[model samples]
Target: MSPSDVSEADAANELMRLAKTIAKHNKLYHAEDTPEIADAEYDALVRRNNELEEAFPHLVREDSPNKLVGAAVAASPLSKVAHEQRMMSLDNGFSDEDIAEWLARVRRFLNLPEGEPVAVTAEDKIDGLSCSLRYERGALVLAATRGDGQIGEDVTANVRMIADIPQALSGETPDVFEIRGEVYMAKSDFDGLNARLMEEGKAEAVAKNVAFDPAKIRQFANPRNAAAGSLRQKDAKITAKRPLKFWAHGWGVASSVPGETAFDVMATIADWGLPLSPLVKRFETLEQMLDHYRHIETERADLPYDIDGVVYKVDRLDWQQRLGFVAKAPRWALAHKFPAEQAQTTLESIDIQVGRTGKLTPVGRLKPVTVGGVVVSNVTLHNRDEIERLGVRPGDRVLVQRAGDVIPQVAENLTRDEEREPYIFPDHCPKCNSEAVAEEGEVDVRCTGGLICPAQRFQRLAHFASRPALDIDGLGEKSIAEFIEAGFLESPADIFRLHQHRDAILARDGWQDKSVDNLLAAVETKRAANAARMLFGLGIRHIGAVSARDLMKKVTRLEEIGVLAEAIEAERSGIEKLPGEEEKKYRQRIDAAVSEVIAIDGVGAAVGHSLADFFHEPHNREVWKDLLKEVKPPDYIVETRDSAVAGKTVVFTGKLETMSRDEAKAQAEALGAKASGSVSAKTDLLVAGPGAGSKMKKAAELGIEVIDEAAWADIVKAAG
Candidate 1:
């Protein structure tokens, strides 16, 4: 009633709202891969809350979200795990200038000479939930999510669902070792999922609102949200359905090991069956590190998953220890985030596309939005289920935002009219008018058009010409698509016949003499590709680069493999009798055998099944046979066993006073030994250099033999 009373009421209401806002933001930014507001907006809310809390100390609640790192784990059937070393969060830098300042601080703390080179390793700061995994005697013992940097919830069961993580180490097992990483959703999987949601009739208002979609209602907001939500699920089955992936980005604790450098540590982790981040790069100078950051930003859109920023850390463990911690985060590392890649756009139209796999994907044709310097007109709608859920129809007003700032997506419907009819998904293929069918146990409605459909054929041809496949560099996706549209290229086999169109292509607009020559050169270069790469270029369903490699290892050439796969399929009466063991075991054996020969650790059954199925398809086999006439896989033999190192587990830790860590690991691998980073009892030998940390102590405790740089040289010389 009085002025003072009113002020008190306003303060209380503001404090309550701040707490709620912070909680929601934490869930969005940390748990969910999506953040509704920009970082500045979230920071403003937090800053206001801090000022108010400082003014009203008594008003500070015990459960304030500001003091927390992330939300609680999901209700998945995962066993609780407690981290031996707490998984602490890193402080962030909003810009390149911010990163430079952080580096300046690091230099000041170390009293380093001006412009002195500081070895830095830059890696993708994956947008996902933080987690730690523990291994004992080579066996996975625990998996936990980073809670408050002090304690974490256990999710071992859910973690086991990820095929990238090894249940057992490769070589000598450690007494105790912990590897830390981020769990995330692959971009492809996320796209597929959103598409499925659109078809299910549970879409929301904003792309942020789409978090409420029924398919993901129980899941988190974005990939990061999905990851955290999946990890925290009380039921393992729930987490399994989310298709979470792990990328080892860092380490927390290891009882014992030898290796002096961060690179050595990562090499060891990779040997232990952890999928390390692909973006990790070593730099000799701060300038090079900055360059890498820029490169990462440029390549962000091309990456298969989301990265909020680039994480820079001292390459050597000794340097990291010398740097130590500043307040809460490590002084040895910094997170450099790129500018936000989100924008508001009007929904001009919505279109449906049929994929090479026949799955229908919904794409939003937006009113040309500019985000982070890129002009985006189309955003992925995910699936028909998502359309129904968002209640989005043609002509509805909408807001579009890019997930990870690369994949443009409809964030949500900004405004809609009840008079507009809901966008109905076509029951037939748009390209061929074939009957579209949704398979049992599948989320997408697929067209049975196969290679006959124009869209599928074009996509397949484009994929076959991709850089990693046949490597027809000049045959860009746009060029391939255009050629297909112009009736120049029709199928994967047609790419070989492109010589016939040289004059025609040269006559076309923008087709200069140099361009034509480049295209021809690219095609010629692909004629003698390695078997694995050729198989990948085929663009078979579920047959990815990894599977293609696996298929190659089974048979020396494409012809033999095609015949073998056909014979195996012909001998079968049904899917049950297709090959070898039960469908699952048969696929697992193929994976294990292929992985063993290629030395590609962690290749799983899913990849193997996809390869086998592809090879068994009559149409696919016929296409391959025709293509093989023009292109031949190189006749090179991959040695599966040459040295004891081939299967031996070797752990490297501490500083290598002699050879560089990378050189050491390479030498070990050459000798058939699996060179690892951390030290454990299973570690055949701990290569200790000066300044070895806890890993050295653990190796000593475990009675694992410890060797210096000289001793390692002697061992290598003796083996040779």
Candidate 2:
């Protein structure tokens, strides 16, 4: 629906979800250096948020995407540094019209005569980690990342190792200056890094008496990610080993001004032994600026480093200062970004693939087309709602962009209006004939068959053998599917019994004595398993590798998962249908009967509900019992660093204005506190915000200490 058509309540809820979603992506891209979505997808979400905010200006969220600059640097091992001048990100534009409008705005802001010439400097914006290098007495002293614009992680030792960054100035310079630049890895260097990492992984596997599996090796997805990961290392040695390079773009906190113009200062930086963009030049008019942008795009493929766009800024420093800043970007500068690469193709058919979680994802089979030199045959339709939104049917023409890591993304359905019939989405699982339903407020329809469905079973079994889970060397997705097709594998327990079918396996193609031996031996080695990995492998909802590990830190054995599930069920059962008892009393009767699982650090209501649902199912319980009988997973015992709230149960309620709910949970975990969903008698503290409702009242009645977001932030800062 359009922004104008959406209800205020719906818009508010969507904006809330969008804030959380965008925050997650920001953390993945900026902090983790492992992006989960393509740039186009991320931009689409931001654009949607902007539209909603525009339509409902009164309902703008405090944690809106507009207010965020970058991600926080709190989780890093390195110490933090505060930037003297905020390292701002440039606002982006995609078309020549946008550039013209920006120039018009600049002229109007300065009250300049129409048709007068304005000098604007254009430079390549390389995709890399933003770093600020501070020099005192013409000598490099500190290097920090551009985290959240204000505070950043200190990487002084790491930047000193980069050959491109000089330890000291070459000639005359400011006594105190900070040069802001991009720390990047060239395409060739990135390829070499990935190759080296894979070889080292192989060597380590061999040393551990395990078969080599190249698929298990972690690799940098792109040059940008490689550069970020290399520079943010805890060890300076690792950064020195990486082929990291830098180019100066701007300056900050200078003791004195170097030049009157941006171009002049950039040249001074280059003269002072820092790398500057070779193509940097001043443009006299909008046409010249746009031409330079097009020229850069034409030669982007030949550039040594990855650059997403060209940045243009007012040449005169006086004019820039006069224009001043917007919220997160300068009013005088704009980034002209290249559009995502696209190709026209026909949507031949749509196929639904069920994931381990039973999520039904629609994939569009396309006529073979080339996009940015890569041949694409498939496009991800995302979900059932996306299919309906696109109004696409079989044989419709569509535009596809090469965006995702594995497949192209469906950009638009060109023949939507010419559709003969609307394609009907399946209400039942295409793989198992089981009823599939989309949960309320959810876009993706999922099969409720759980473990009984063959599709879910195959997916779940494959997940159990994945690198982060069981880490079986020879077991892969295709091989697992083959075993299932042959009826040799019924569940995860069947994996351990594979040795019994040795002669049967040998009769099949691609089966050898050494290969089969390696596969079974790999399974045997994991008999003494890490309980955390085992729990993650079970494909339980809301329990990821990290959360599984967090939960295991409290539990002695994997069997407690079922016990916790039962305790949760019993608590809910007792509360069910208490006539004349309001929803408030159900929570008030919180004696010792409440499940401890829900109160465990990092394991809250969401995870407790998922565990309860899993254990309540007979098929899931049978699979769990059979799998445990085959493989003996020992207790998960590990140490967590102590903090102020280390054994205390804490509850967060109401609208978190500055941070997302997930981020709040992460902070609680980092502080070694238990983040619980419900406020019970055990809750030591209640972090409440506006609209706290029932939880806040309960906390008051229970006499728990209440604090707001700012207070919680102080607690986190104190812990740090």
Candidate 3:
């Protein structure tokens, strides 16, 4: 989503959602060793979060992903180790321009002049597990995983077996040092390990005299996962059997002086017999570093281990310390990541699914293909327009891109020119067979079924009990869905009858006597609710709280609105627009029919038509009548202060230059006058502005007191 399209409130809500999503992925990847999405998809989430935060900085939440590093080690099975130094994550950049901008920012922070030679070290960022090995007097004493960059899981026994991780240092070493690096498995070793696992599972099943099921064999998704799963074992013997390798990237919690430059420290670590990336090099210019990144990317495919990007760090440790960090990443270092993973797969089929709000979304099924170490079989088409834009159909070869989005998109339809029947979007709801129509100037097609549509009923009920509607406490979205699934709730009326199912609800899981009683008590409190709130709770198309209250103020009772709806329906039907009817004549005919409904301020022909159509629907009418039987809404009333215009029916027409139509009505209300939308026998005064037209003429015909925008402003001034 673009930043311009999102408001502060929407950005705040999205940031909250992104924080939870990123945290979930972090736990799956770091703590549990099971990742749901590819690294690119996860990165996309973080990118979106960063974009929103940049756009609306004030709305950045406390729990934002930017403030977090890795998953907490609380969920791990192994013992915990408190680290002396926190392991920081590096900020990521995906393009040459991004790297250049990063370098510019570093120079700005250091107050370095333009074109200054800022030396930096670059290395391939390996996709593997992060481990911290602590050495006391040249001997490996403890090894721990980087969990939340703080306390970590103690894997000292597990790392002791890996030959690549030396148990004792061979060169001059510090009295106390904690070296941080990656535990990785090579691509070839990962393949062989997966094969061996499947074969061993088959052999064990044969030994047990059971039929071997290959589907039940669990294999790692990629090399990174293989290394993580193999290393994080409770039994070190299992870790010893697995081919795991370790390489030092940097050091943490060190006592003695090692090197002033990052590259020099890496040289000392290599001298201490720790594995290091041979491709690591130092560059003096941004251009040289970016060029080195490109070269490393070219060699990425042929590399022994999986590398997603190139990490660049300031050569001088003093500059790194001075630059410090922001949120969770160091300002002096950045990882120039690779682009999104793309793979071509066949578009098997397309399916339309209706969301809670009745939005019909199209999802495309794909032939299982691996992209960025994850098997992708489904992609969201978003809407009908996207499908038409792609011209995608079953059997078409489509290039799916896992470009940092949770759901992969159809990047290109390779067989778009192939002779095939074009996919047709359904005009009816799949759940209820109701006519699905897209609103004017809208892209999404929605079902008009409202409460009758099973897909929308859950949300409808939840909204009905929401604060804006009946304000019934204890009936949240989750509880409402649980009630509906348990057959305890189907409509808003069923909420009042939940007392009958109190025992039934108590019998089910998670429902106690006190909670059930509290819910029932809250529902019982709405028996004598406000007429406008009750009407708004019905989830009608055009009727809102203000419009509902306006209609109720004129009609008095809830039943009268039904009668008025029938009246408008009958009047409009008799004067229905004929074929070849002129626009003016048709407008006059409709205006005459819905004159009574339009007379109410804040409501117009839209509300009249919506009410008529809603009352005409058999299901809606039945539900409305059923809800009324359980609920008795009071007549809407306003206690107004005494004023000159008090108790007078005032009608406003045409363009109100000084104030909005609603503002005019609100001023009239403040003066104790009843603001109306039409000039009629009951209208005592008419406030006319430019292009008043028919209303002004009608007021003259009815002999009502007429005034301009200036005169209305005087009346409000006099009231003050």
Best by TM-score: 3
lDDT of 3: 0.81
lDDT of 3 at 479: 88
TM-score of 3: 0.58
How far in Å is the alpha carbon of 139 misplaced in model 2? 1.4
Q: Judge candidate 2 at residue 136 and give its lDDT.
A: 95
Residue pairs in candidate 3 whose N, alpha carbon or C atoms collide under 3 angstroms: none
Q: How close is candidate 1 to the true structure, as a TM-score?
A: 0.44
TM-scores of the models, in the order given: 0.44, 0.56, 0.58
> Which parts of model 1 have CA positions greater than 4 angstroms off?
1-318, 321-348, 355-359, 367-377, 395-408, 413-421, 437-447, 473-488, 498-525, 567-602, 639-648, 651-720
Model 3 weakest lDDT span, ten residues long: 7-16
Candidate 2's residue-wise lDDT over 86-117, tens digit each?
98877777789989988887886677777788
lDDT of 1 by residue, 1-720 (tens): 222333432444456445655765665555334555555445556657766755654444433443455644322245445556556667666666767777776676566777687778899888777878888877997888876565567888888888777788887756888888888887777766655656544544364464444434442235555566666777888777777888898777777764788888888888777888887988876678888888888998888887878898888787676565532367688877665556776777778888767778888787876764335667667677778778887677776654343346566686665577778888899999988886432446887767788778877777677655676777887898878877887667678788888899998999998999888887887778777777767665545554455456667666776665554444332333245457555443544443343332323333333445666667766777778778876864565665544666787777665555655775685566767767755588778888888988898899887778887887777777
lDDT of 2: 0.81
RMSD of each: 23.2, 12.2, 16.5
What tens-digit string does per-residue lDDT give for candidate 3 at 385-437? 88899999999999988632234678899999999999999999999999999
